[model samples]
Target: MSDEPERQIKALTGALMEVYETLRLICLHLPVPIQLPRGPEYDLNTLVPAVSRLIEIIGDQPMREDEQSLVWGSALNWTAAAKLYSRYLLTGGDFVSRLELELLIQTAGEGLIIYLDGPDSTTQE
Candidate 1:
């Protein structure tokens, strides 16, 4: 019983890492001098669904109202990040800029660490 939360957190962390890797790969391979979207068909709309899926995968439990809000906020941040990346790509910015990409990856990795290590109410203090 005591191990359940730990196991769940571990699984969530793994899933997040997988998603982050996919995002990193996309960023790496996105064409240089990106073709900017001219219509609704090729907009950043796709990122919203991805962010929702990520939140669904990482956070599936019922939560207090406040916690639910916080989760939604985090999801929004993820969505915004995706949109920003898309914009950067569309503007012909270097998609594989080493410094920026490294920072993004490092931030995601640190986030995974925090998610894994954060205190769980189910665990003993």
Candidate 2:
């Protein structure tokens, strides 16, 4: 039998790399220089949110390929969640990251991606 876990890891890594590259390029354009009071220990926590904000922008921005325009509804795609979870493992302490990962898995399994905004036309700060 095939090793399902290994397969999942591979797929998720591929997707993450793709999304990460795209976001990394966008991060280069962030107007504000990020400054942290602490050190590398907080890099993951601080950088992750910055990246999350970029993800939101990416979801709204359209990509053009082969004369087609494609937009991501959210970064929480099923395969992407695995990458995020693995990141959470490496990032160390963070309860919010853990919850987001679980919710991503649950929603992805249901064939849906959750956005940062509420259904009632409000946004989350």
Candidate 3:
């Protein structure tokens, strides 16, 4: 494998870490009553596995454009979903809105896991 995929993984993981830090800041400001879950939908649950697989893929081969895009898109989704959840929580939303936030978190997590098993894999695995 070339250094290109290594470089790409570094860049992608850096962007992902920025998103993670931003979300952590958001969490710090969330209402005291609204503790984020340590459950399956936790951001790290999405981030850790994805980053691990990305590292493996970088070590094994180059990334296709579609795979790169999916990873980047998932980072954005994680950011958007977290922000929306935080905003809704801070604004005193209803239970239905809370449920919607849960769905957003879950969906963003699903998006992040698209490459969890490697370059040719899907979330279905």
On TM-score, the leading prediction is: 3
The C-alpha local distance difference test score for the whole of candidate 2 amounts to: 0.42
Q: Worst 10-residue stretch by lDDT in candidate 1?
A: 31-40
**Candidate 2 positional error at 110, Å:** 19
* Model 1 TM-score relative to the real fold: 0.36
Go through the candidates in order and give the C-alpha RMSD of each one to the true structure: 16.1, 11.6, 18.0
- Residues 1-125, candidate 3: write the lDDT tens digits: 56854554354444445545443343334232112333324465555554344333432334455555554455456655445544654575555765565555555455445545455665355
Model 1 bad stretches (over 4 Å): 1-47, 52-60, 63-74, 94-109, 120-125
Which ranking of candidates, highest TM-score first? 3, 1, 2
TM of each candidate vs. truth: 0.36, 0.33, 0.43
Query: What's the lDDT for all of these models?
Result: 0.44, 0.42, 0.48
Mind giving the per-residue lDDT tens digits that candidate 2 earns over 1-125?
Answer: 35854555455445444443443443343343222123323234454565445444543433322111111323334335655666765665265765665566555433211221213322245
Which candidate gets the maximum lDDT versus the true structure? 3
Clashing pairs in 2: none
